[model samples]
Target: MKKNTLFVFALFIFYFSFCLTTVAQTRSREDYEKLGHVVWEVDTKEKIVAITFDDGPHPVFTPQILYILAKYNAKATFFVAGNKVKRFPSVLERIAKEGHEIANHTYNHIINRNITSSTLHSELEQTDEIIQSIIGYKPTLYRPVGGMHNDLIINTAVKNGKLVILWSWHLDAEDWKNPAASQISRHITKGIRPGNIVLLHDWIGTEYSRTSQTVKGLETTLRFLYQNGYECVTVSELLFRSEIIDQDYFNTFPIE
Candidate 1:
């Protein structure tokens, strides 16, 4: 009888914890917007969007992505890893030279949950130093590794003078999974809204072909946006261009 009772109690505890996690993950974007440091997407009516790339500065893919951006006359934000920056300093310089924004993606791309506060600070500091060395200034924006964060991460990042940047919930192209270029392009273009922050990856591991697909997919999406009279700008541009009033309620909430 006691064994059965303990099993039932265990199940109840598991179910209760699941419910709490669900609630935490489902908080509205407005709730986050009010926090001043978390910005997933800006509220605006202009025909512009922020196309951001992460895990990049690859010797080959970075230049390809840069050429495409130059061809379309679009600016983007590159959230590059510090370790990659050390290996490809020139590529990082080119990203800065091209008038794109360079944000920090941590030193080793360690996710927030896996690291302690001290480790997180070290990651940010090391990345900041490398980026500053290459770009002549430190980055003000920081995207948590894997888009995962907690109160400790957020508070620590704020203390370090970084704003936590994330992508629009509907705008992730999921190009890392090596989807068809057409599908990836269509997904981004369809979800393109004013002030939308689109997420893409330039260096997706050693899978050379996968990153190539992202390049191809981005080309198609850029062509569509260029021809459709949409200006693709960096994340900072999107934020500044928008007249976001603190009291205004954003219609959609991005997943936490």
Candidate 2:
């Protein structure tokens, strides 16, 4: 009788542990699917990656970067701030004209979590308006400021017909802090992988003359990706190639 009771208790503990683990895994998968964000890498058996530049449409750096991308015949995504769009409308047109995808990076580039739903919607909607006015089409993609996203922001974005894009890899160039271009490039090259979304900035400090180092680093990074057989593409193409569901998963949420 004593042995049987002990055996039952041990089985019960094991079963409970298994159930918890199963629940956790299920929740993780559900979260990944609903977010529509890149959570895990897909084994496509081909070397491909997406390069994205955010907080841009700057007067000096943006044009130079576009020139390089055009010269290489490479396509990338630019998440432009709405205020910047208003400041440099021509740059926005140039980006669309070059065949690269333009995505919303919000109006003021503020932390979404700190803002109310109405404020968040305004940020996104105004940006979309600015982008559409310039590009003649509404952008379908968005990247939250600083890659900081939450349930509220994601829901708001989905309701407004935007897909929240997050990077699988980051360059951490800290261009805002004036980090060296070589250091940024080295970080990216050392950490480069298939299906990676390499992050860089076309916007820099007021005192900076030109992003010559970033341009040089971009050249080096592109050459390395090419040599490694990785085909750089836009974010949408990457997601489509990976077969992410098109239907909005957070549609039930309110837009504003």
RMSD of each: 5.7, 10.0
Q: Which numbered prediction scores highest in TM-score against the true structure?
A: 1
- How does residue 144 of candidate 2 score in lDDT? 84
Q: TM-score, each model?
A: 0.83, 0.79
Provide the overall lDDT of each model, using Cα atoms, as 2-decimal numbers. Answer: 0.83, 0.75
CA shift at 233, candidate 2, in angstroms? 0.6
**Which run of 10 residues does model 2 get worst, by summed lDDT?**
21-30
* TM-score, structure 2 vs. true: 0.79
Clashing residue pairs in candidate 1, if any? none
Encode model 2's per-residue lDDT on 166-199: one tens digit a residue. Answer: 7764545555555666776778888877777777
